[model samples]
Target: MPDITHEEWLRRAESWKVSGAHHIDGADEPGGGATFTVVSPRDGRVLAEVADGGTAEVDAAVAAARRAFDTGPWPRLAPAERGRVLLRIADLLEERREELALTVSLEMGKPVTEAYAIELRAVIGTFRWYGHLADKLTDESPHTPQDALALVTREATGVVGAVVPWNFPLTLAGWKVAPALAAGCTVVLKPSENSPLSALLLGRIATEAGLPPGALNVVAGNGPVAGRALGLHPDVDVLAFTGSTAVGRHFLHYAADSNLKRVWLELGGKSPNIILPDAPDLAKAAATAAWGIFFNQGEMCTAPSRLLVHSSVAEQVTDAIVARADALRVGDPLDPATEMGALVSAGHLGRVLDHVGTGLDEGARLRAGGERTLTGTGGSYLRPTVFDRVAPGMRLSREEIFGPVLSVLTFDDLDEAVALANATEYGLAAGLWTSDLSTAHRVSRALKAGTVWVNCYEEGDLSVPFGGMKQSGNGRDKSVHALEKYTELKTTWIQL
Candidate 1:
């Protein structure tokens, strides 16, 4: 499909409707409980009244997933057959590409263009990649005595409880759900209360693509209710979560307090992007620094919120970034020309603004774009903000702001640069822009983040594993390695 005009996108948004009930047993369930109003940050309008799933709803969903895993055909099917089903699901998602994109953009305040290109692309690619990889996996057999045979194989770990955040709802859910389903495990997905529409849509697509009843379920509610129940459920063999570091810790505690199920976390980050004086393209590095923090309104876990620049070129790089930030168009998300959209919600915007205030009070120089904007529309909009001459010890430099807020810190040498970059509690991702191969290799190795980009920020492929170290949480997402999280190894010995 071609790119539509902004007016066309607005027309589609007016006509769009969302699914608001919990999906269980291949159908939508009203849950017979109270509902919560979901407000769009794009225009501060009430989108829908989503079912507020609680422990009872969690129980039903988990029970459905448990039945599917224990006695259903989903787990008993051949790997190749299951692979075909996943491929069909991918095709179905592609078929509803426009609809799904609209749902995501309306629910989460992402640009319609980006929701179509980046978000849907990732979701579709994840399922398609895992589908192709499902049957190609192999088991292992070890050498043994002449009269004996030994075989080691992978088995599905049973029901998976996936709790994903709202920033990139469909993409993050797809990262967990596609791999778990590909590994022959049933799933009970609990999306964030702020953005559950797209996830409910995903559940319907899965059932329509020939998945058996009870194989995949979606429950939408607040974190303390449905998410807590899923984390503490004894029947779920594994729980995969992507959210804040504090929430990630709660899942670990829930695992220990309940069934000791395997818990995999992909948590928060305050990643650093370093620019050396010898960068191959200083202008490009500065532009990317602006894009890195401003993209998705900086609600990304791996957003380069901190920019560490060499002292000699700090002024030049900082000025370039400020210019780019000033040039960014902050407006309606449906407009294809708008580079930055609204924050996810009013509460989230308040939190981010508080952090901005703290930064100013802590003595960081506000370079450009530090206040709220577009108030006439009643949308949760903020300017692309940048703070220069940030000290290493400041709160803005250490905490994961998780917004379109950038902190610029200067370093005199390579040692100080690396030390400053590694100072934060997060180590999810980092970026470096340099021309020298030796410096690139040295800095990339020394950076403590899980993924380090030499000249790019947030560029990734399904072939590489993505996760974090330290307080950023644990385990891997994407690639074949992700399947390991949903499967267990079993060894069988035969004697002749």
Candidate 2:
């Protein structure tokens, strides 16, 4: 496909206007609360006026989900029948690919081309993969010495509350909703207030795909109000959330206080990307490191923000990465040619800037692109930032700065590199760049992260599990492990 110009991208975004306040019980209506503007991060243009839902609305949504799961046909439907509905939703997403991508780009400020190619496509693929796997989930039979019959069954965990971040709204929503629905559970989703349009649109698609009323509901609201209510609701059986580590801890506390509902959180990260001197193709390693940190404006939880370079080629790798970061295009997200887009909102941009200031105060050298704003851009734009000579103890190296900032740290040997990488409290994800078979195997085993990519960065597939360890939060989001989170296994024995 040819690259889309900025003007064309804007036009495409303007053309996608499926408006409503909320989608509850398989229908759309203006929410009870006042309307809020969903602005374009490219130019601060008013993309749409979305309904800002609150506690009452959340209660109603949860009630609807509970009613659907209790008395509706969704949970009673055969696994194959439920799979058909999910497959239909995936097909509908593909049919409206352009609109979905445009809405995502406008809401979250990701490059339009990348949003279409990566985010939307991945969402569709996730639905299809889980849909096919639904039928394969079955109960087990056991043999015993006694004259008795035994069976182990997997049952849906009833109502689920899914709260997704603005970084990858649709894709993350799919991560939570697809498996829940496939496992015969009903879901009420709360999208981030900064970017709720795409998820609302997805709710409409779910209805069109013939999902039962209240099986999938979209409630758009802030974290303090709607998100807190979802986590604390007694009726919600499971809470699946993806956001900052601070908020994840709060959700865990809320779950503990409110009915002890199962909470699955995929939270923050300062993931490390280690590059040993023996790695073949230094240029490729440097480019991958740059993309790993700068992709999606570094808003991803799995983004490799820490670069650990061997002392022998630390200077060489840092120089190459700096050059690549400098070359990244930071402009209107609607422009297909653009590589980086604005942060999700003005407040987030300010927080990212504050982290840059903290880095400078910690005495780290700002090697390139620090505290620079895009000229003539109306949105919350920040230039790609790189810090060199950063020690592991520095705030910038330890904290999860969810922006386009890369911190380069040098290590004298492989053992030190592994120690520095695992020093942080977080263990979401990490990367290694090397060609030596023994070194790669040794380092991959030593890393404390949940997912380790050797010679690659941020590469994910639907078949593999995705989640975090330590302070990054628990419970897998993708793969068959996700199904386990959404289900409960029961064992029964009977005398023959």
Candidate 3:
């Protein structure tokens, strides 16, 4: 497909009619009297009046899911039959990729190109991948004496409640929903209030792909209302969430307070990207570091926000990164030429600016981009910021700002670099650039992170698992292991 012009994208945006309602039982319904205004970060324009769901809507969605799980054909169908539905969903998503990508770009400030190329690509691939594997899974049988036979089987764990954040709304939801559905579990998905339009569309698409009436439902509301309700729902057998660590803790508490449903969380990160003097290519490492921090406007859970470089190469790498940051084009999300788009919201932009202020107050040198940009456009825009001479104890290094902000800290030796990278409470991901084979092996093993990228950043495949450790959260998101979250093992013993 050829790339569309920016004017063409703007024309399409003008005609795009967005829906704002709770998707339940294969239909759209109005929420309880209240509504929240969704403002696009691209130009701070009001996009739609979304239903503000609460306990009642959550209960309805959960009940629908429960009924589907207990009595509907979705759970009872043969594994191969279920796989066909998932494959159909993937095809449907492909047919409507333009509509979905436009919706995500308008709702969350992601560049339309990225929304098409990266986000939709991931969503389609996930459903297709899980669909292909659905019928391939096999149950286990143990050897026993002739008098007795034992069989162990995997059963769908009833209803699944998935709560995803604003960034990468569709992709993150797919990570949890596709596998759960493939495992034969009905789902009640709660998308963050900031980005709900796309999820609502996805729910409609799933129904068109021939899912049972209640196989998938999407409720849009704030974390305290719909999210909390899903977490505390008694009938939900499993809960999967992707968001902040602070919210992850709330779900854990809600589980303890309710039926103790199995909860899987993929939370925050303050990942470090290290560059050594003996790196294979200093310029390439510097460029990747810039891309790592600035991608998606730096609103990613696995974003490499910390840059730890050996003292011998720190200046060259930092200077290269600053040059790249300055050259990035931040503008309208619908524009194809935009390399960086607006922040998610005005409030988030303010929060990021506050962190920049804190870094300056704490004595870190602001080498580039310390102020707000493009204020006349009424959009939430910030220049990509870089802070050098940062100490390990600084808040800029320790906490997740979740924006296009980078903190560069210099280390003298391999041990010091590894120590700095492992100092964070969040252990979601890390990246190191080195040419020495022995050093790469030793350092990769020493880093306390779920994924360590050697000489690369954010490169991954669907076959491998992705998750976090320590304060970042627990449980994997991708791969066949994700099925473990939505299914349970059952043992049956027969005596002849």
Candidate 4:
């Protein structure tokens, strides 16, 4: 209908203020309830006021979800019926794609183009993927002697509390919520305060799509307030969260202190993007590596913040990467042509710059951009930054700098490359670019991350499992593996 622009986005943002009551038991849409102001990272402007809650709303949401799982018709429905409802939700998401994308852009400060082309598409695809998958789940039967029968059944783990981060809000939330809903588990979703509008809107769209009351809940607030309550609530059977490793650990204690509920965490990463001397195309590898770290302002958990290269080609790759970094367009997020946008908030911008300063002091040479670009619109804009000659022991290479900063490291051999890639405690994802099939196979297996890309970066499919290893956290997010997180297995034996 209308070309994407800041004016049109702001017009809508001003009107969508007052994020309302928690969507518990499927109350008719939302009302005036958002307890906090949602500021647009594009400018220091109040985009909206979203609903906020503490232990009270968390308790109510858990109660509603518990009732839904224990006695509601949702859990009793045929798998096909559940699939149909999820499909309807996917349809509605596409119908409202533009508005949803704009809402995400206004709140999360991602480029509108990426918001529409990448994120919105992925959000819709996830629902449809899980929708179709709903009916595919079946129980297992064990072979037994003639006198007895044994059955292994996977049942809903009951109420789920999902806490999502600001970056990739809806897509990440979908990773947690979709499979859980498909498996018949009710959910209380706590979206990041920095970007709650899309999830809040989803609460309304879901009800319009025929989801039963209490089946899905969206609580908008900070992790300490609403999230702690969700974690500590005895009725919440599972806590599925995607955020920092620090916060993920906090939820563990909440679970231990409460009901010992199951916890599935998709936490932090400093994923490595390695390029061997045999890379088929150094240009392509360099371009892709730059995009991997700078896309979404380098806010991705799997952003490939570290780049390990064979010493033979290290200088060439670094030069190409710096060129790509310097060429990125950084400014207003609402403009469709913008390649990168602001960090999520002013505070986040400070953190990013702080990391850059620390990197400079740690002796990493600044090869490209290393300063914040004031947008003149109060947006938290940062130039795509690159650091060369980064040592493995330096914090610049070790810490997860969740900004548009890339650290270049050199390796003399494949063994050293693999060791450098796996040295980080966080191992959510890794990538390698090479023409050698044997090296690809060998290095892919040696990397201890959950997902490894042989010749690409950040390419994904809903059918694959997404998660981490070691301190990056446990369990998976996408595919059938994710559904397992929301279910409990029970073995039934009967004597005939």
Give the alpha-carbon lDDT of every model. Answer: 0.93, 0.89, 0.94, 0.88
TM-score of each: 0.99, 0.98, 0.99, 0.97
What C-alpha lDDT, on a 0 to 100 scale, does residue 122 get in candidate 4? Answer: 89
Model 1: colliding residue pairs = none
Looking at model 4, report the run of 10 residues with the lowest lDDT sum: 27-36
Residues 126-237, candidate 3, lDDT per residue (tens digit)? Answer: 9999999999999988999999989999999999999999999999999999999999999999998999999999999999999999999999898998899999999999
Error of 4 at 26 (Å): 0.7
> Runs in model 1 with CA error above 4 Å?
none
lDDT by residue (1-496, candidate 1, tens digit) is 4479999989998888987999998999999678999999999999999999999999999999999999999999988988899899999999999888888888889898899899999999999999999899999999999999999999999999999999999999999999999999999999999999999999999999999988899999999889999999999999999999999999999999999999999999999999999999999999999999999999999999999999999999999999999999999999989889999999999999999999999999999988999999888999999999799889999888889999999999999999999998999999999999999999999999999999888897999999999999888999999999999999999997
Name the regions of candidate 4 deviating beyond 4 angstroms.
1-18, 28-34
> Which pairs clash inside model 2?
none
What ranking of all candidate models by lDDT puts the best one first?
3, 1, 2, 4
- lDDT: which is higher, 2 or 3? 3
Among all windows of 10 consecutive residues in model 1, the one with the lowest summed lDDT is: 1-10
Give a tens-digit lDDT track for model 2, residues 232-299: 99999999999998998889999999999999989899999999988888889999998888899989
The candidate, 3 or 4, that scores higher on lDDT is: 3
Give model 3 RMSD, 1 decimal: 0.9
